[model samples]
Structures are given as structure tokens and as C-alpha cells.
Target: MVIEGWGVNENIEMVDRVAHCANKLQGWGKRKRVKFKEDI
Candidate 1:
């Protein structure tokens, strides 16, 4: 379930747009969200 291909199958237009936007704003670290690990 990575954000490369499977995450953007096509039907999820909003997701694709957001991910693409994040890629561009990565330098600024503007991308929001906190990913947690099961082990943690």
C-alpha cells in the first residue's frame, strides 16, 4: 500500500492530487500527517 502506484489507482483523484502536491512541497515539509508503526 505504497503511495507510488497502488495508492493512486485513478479513481482516487483527490489522493493523487494531494500526493503530487506533497512531492512538490516536500522541501518545505508542508506535508501533514503522522504515520505510526505497529511495533512502536
Candidate 2:
């Protein structure tokens, strides 16, 4: 998941995309009763 050697804008976009996906998964887990414990 590391945005290695990427430009500033690209790095931000990558982070935003990951956050968005994580949020979606979090919501899905809530509905399905799946536990998503933080790994770090």
C-alpha cells in the first residue's frame, strides 16, 4: 500500500482511494457481522 516515489498529488489520491475502500469495507462488515480488527 505504500505509494513509493510518487508525486504529491498521486500520493494523496492513492491514500484517499484506500481510505474510501476501507470505509466501504467497514460498513459492509457492520452489516454482515464480520469483525475487522485493526492490525496496527
1-40 per-residue lDDT for model 2 (tens digits) = 1233333355368677677667766667686664444432
Kindly report which residue stretches of model 1 are placed more than 4 angstroms away from their true locations once superposed.
Answer: 1-12, 28-40
How far residue 22's Cα lies from its native spot in candidate 2, in Å, is 0.1
Error of 2 at 6 (Å): 18
Q: Candidate 2: deviation at residue 27, Å?
A: 0.2
lDDT of each: 0.52, 0.56
RMSD to the hidden true structure, all candidates = 8.3, 8.5
The superposed Cα distance between candidate 1 and the true structure at residue 23, in angstroms, equals 0.3
Worst 10 residues of 1 by lDDT: 30-39
Q: How many backbone clashes does candidate 1 have?
A: 0
lDDT score, candidate 2, position 11: 36
lDDT for each residue of candidate 1 in 1-40, tens digit (9 for 90 to 100)? 1355334555667777677656656633432323233334
